[model samples]
Target: MVRRLSIWAVGLVIAACAQAPAVPPQASAQETPIAEYGFGVLADLAGTRWRGEPGEADKEHGQPADYSEWDWDLGGSVLVNRHVLEDGSYGGVTYVQLSRKPGVLDYVYITSANFRTSGTMTLNADGSWTAEEDVKGLPHILKVRSTGRRHADGTMSGVSEFLGDDGEWTPGHSFTYSQTTAPLPDLVPSGSPPE
Candidate 1:
């Protein structure tokens, strides 16, 4: 009687297995469609505040050193970047998301300077990202482009240029950022620069 019960249980298990649907091997988390499309390319930047001293051009332009922090929002569907000068003189917040086009990202930057930019960022084969933006509310510039690269030593650097009246690209912002724990200046809300 025990052998018959064991056979019955085995038959039930076989029936259940035969009825189960076949599922192909699933991709790993990193190989998911969103990740493969480069949605999380900047994920490593989250979780740390970075500091960068003002470049010579920044000093010439009266800009101060800055701190930047990045984080994932909306369950990792968006990347948010916040930056503030060490002196509390300037700051900006940026929101980035995967563009409709694969391997590209769309971003909007709102500055404390009463200007904002809409841009697209793309990753280069060399592990760098380039951003091209159209400026608004700032009469002196029309468009801007920048490239940022992360170094093996965990430092980040970027070079930017602005479109000039001559249709030429002139030097713009530059910075080399490293992880920081120092206090950062306050960033007044976007569209509401301090008096």
Candidate 2:
């Protein structure tokens, strides 16, 4: 009888150890979706003035120049606060911001043009996000459709495209915003945020 009781006790211990712990249903209910984050860069193509190639400058002097034929490159990332939306979706707006510093080429010349921007991100239930910003009297908008998953270490990667008013498509600008926990320092002044 003593041996039988000992075996029963061991079996009970094993069974208890094998059973999964009870996870509260509400815990899952309150869980937020995986968040996303990233950075971006933008070039003011409209402000670009193309002085023809070095030798061609002399050939095209004093002529009505064409500023419309210039190249601009814009890129950036977003740091999403929450990965999912409130409606059981995969994303939502959290406490995160997008920032940009001017490129080397943008600063070399003494042009009155300034390169700066600031904006917020909103993740949609359908795995999409919209980034909106107003900078230097121009409005910038980006719409992203997530095409990837969040990793175990809390990182997500996805592609995004830029949209413009007047229903026209801008060329040569695309981005991939990644989510990270790394802290970013404030580059702007005390009362204002950097663009």
Model 2 alpha-carbon drift over 4 Å, by segment: 1-113, 126-128, 137-155, 163-167, 171-195
lDDT of 2 by residue, 94-187 (tens): 2223323211011111111222323433322233333443233224422211122223343222222334454543331121122222332212
TM-score of each: 0.74, 0.24
Give the lowest summed-lDDT range of ten residues in model 2: 102-111
In model 1, the runs with Cα more than 4 Å from the true position are 1-35, 188-195
TM-score of 1: 0.74
Q: 67-149, model 1: which lDDT tens digit per residue?
A: 77777898988877777766665667788787877557778877776777787776544455556778777655677777666
